[model samples]
Target: MARVIFLLVAVVSVFQALAAPLHSRAVTSPQCSQFNVYASAAIDEARLSLGSINTGNDIGNARNILQAQLSLLDANTGVTEIADSLLTSAPPAPANASATVVAGLQAALASLNQIFFLADNTTKAAVAAANASMITALDNAQQAVAANCQTTLN
Candidate 1:
């Protein structure tokens, strides 16, 4: 009777273990989707503003545009922080969203810094370098999202 009871208990325990809940993966996937959409939109708008900067001789207008781009970048940085927290804590299968965001942001900020220096000096070579850096940064951002962010941004 004692052996039979022990076997019964063991079977029940195994059944319970098999029925245990897994880490929820769907919970944070939406956040990732929203983040991808918002970040892409923000980057696109900033690029548009930056594109306009070279066409005009108005220093004041250019400064305003640059300030807008900076503001957008700042907002993106905040979103990135939120995304990092959400993605890292997500269970089942968490992607390295934080690393991707950090890399993209670092590259973008470096490009922006270089551009600011070039703008102040108005040197052709420096401007060319800044433009190339900006292009690379934008590409990095795209690749990061494509590689790290799994959710489709709708």
Candidate 2:
């Protein structure tokens, strides 16, 4: 009888130990991680693509890129809404998301010349100023997203 009871206790201990890891992981993996990852990818795209935009394009290529990114923003908000619906939800990453947002904004600034080429020097200065604001916003957003991921947003 003593051997039987000891064996039962050992088996239960092993089962509990295995189950503990699964429970902890489930707790750690917030649904918002999905949103964070996708959002980061979109931001990275903005960062990488910004320099490639041709300021002289009369065909609205830069405009198209901005529109595509804006569409991504819309999708990201949808993901956030779904994540929010869950109990004990993941953190919404306004902090991390701001970096890429700034990138898009910067792209918008550069795109100003494409929209209005012959404007005065003051107008060009305004565009340059807008570009600076975009860069700051984008960096802040990247940091915020990284914080939410807890492992950096990829």
Candidate 3:
């Protein structure tokens, strides 16, 4: 009777465990989705400006555009400025943003920094090196966003 009761308790515990919900992924926040959209636009703009700079076509204009794009990803400038660039209205990123969201934004900011470095140099070799670094940073940012924000963005 003692052995039978022990086996029954074990079966009940296993059934309870099987019935529990799995939390495979974190629930992405709305702020993350907004930031993802804004970051994508900013990165696209920077890429276009970088290409123009690389081709030696209106370097000054390209630099200005690149700077403007970089500002959008800069958190120190204020979230309102970043949200203003969006065609649709979005609330500022929450202070308690998820780790995934913060990681994505940090990656974008690193790319922005790389672009800023690229903007200051016009030499072929310097520009080539900066461009390579900028591309890698941008790729990392994009991958970060795709990992969590793709399915959740508006």
Candidate 4:
């Protein structure tokens, strides 16, 4: 009877082990991660272009635009910090600014992720297209800032 009881307990433990949940860890920051990378690149490119100009006015405006770009990137970074916390911890609906940004970014990331989960192989291409759209938007915004800044400097 003792041996039979021990075998039953072992079987139950094995079954329980198989029932354990699996968790996937992801570490993506809206600021210092992939986001900052692209933003910074755009800024650098704009700044470099401004520097090649002959007029002081144009240079000044370009600088202002770059500054504005940096500000936007900073805001995104703030959001990332909030998101990082939520990812590692339980969902805090009452999160502060960081949390709020994280939630927003999380939503965006989810949208991007869904493109990957779609059954069609076209999903990845679609995701890439979406990403390109975002990059293009940023680029256009940056260009406007640079142009306006240059005008102000002039």
Q: What is the C-alpha lDDT of each candidate?
A: 0.50, 0.45, 0.44, 0.40
**Tens-place lDDT digits, model 3, residues 26-103:** 234565455545545544444454444443544544554355345434422332333332323343334322233344
What is the Cα-based TM-score of model 4?
Answer: 0.28
Alpha carbon lDDT at 66, candidate 1: 56
- For candidate 2, write residues 16-115 as lDDT tens digits: 9887842211121444355444454544454345444443543444464455345445434533432343323344333333344435444444554355
Candidate 4's residue-wise lDDT over 33-130, tens digit each? 33434543443443343233333333433343334334434435544443454456423212233333333333433334433233333433433444
Regions of candidate 3 where Cα sits further than 4 Å from its true position: 26-127, 135-154
Q: Model 4: runs farther than 4 Å from truth?
A: 1-6, 9-57, 85-154
RMSD of each: 10.8, 11.3, 12.1, 18.2
Q: In model 1, state the lDDT of residue 51.
A: 57
Model 2, global lDDT: 0.45
| Arranged by lDDT, best first | 1, 2, 3, 4
Q: Which stretches of candidate 2 lie over 4 Å from their true place?
A: 1-118, 149-154
- Pairs that clash in candidate 2: 95-144, 96-141, 96-144, 96-145, 98-141, 99-138, 99-141
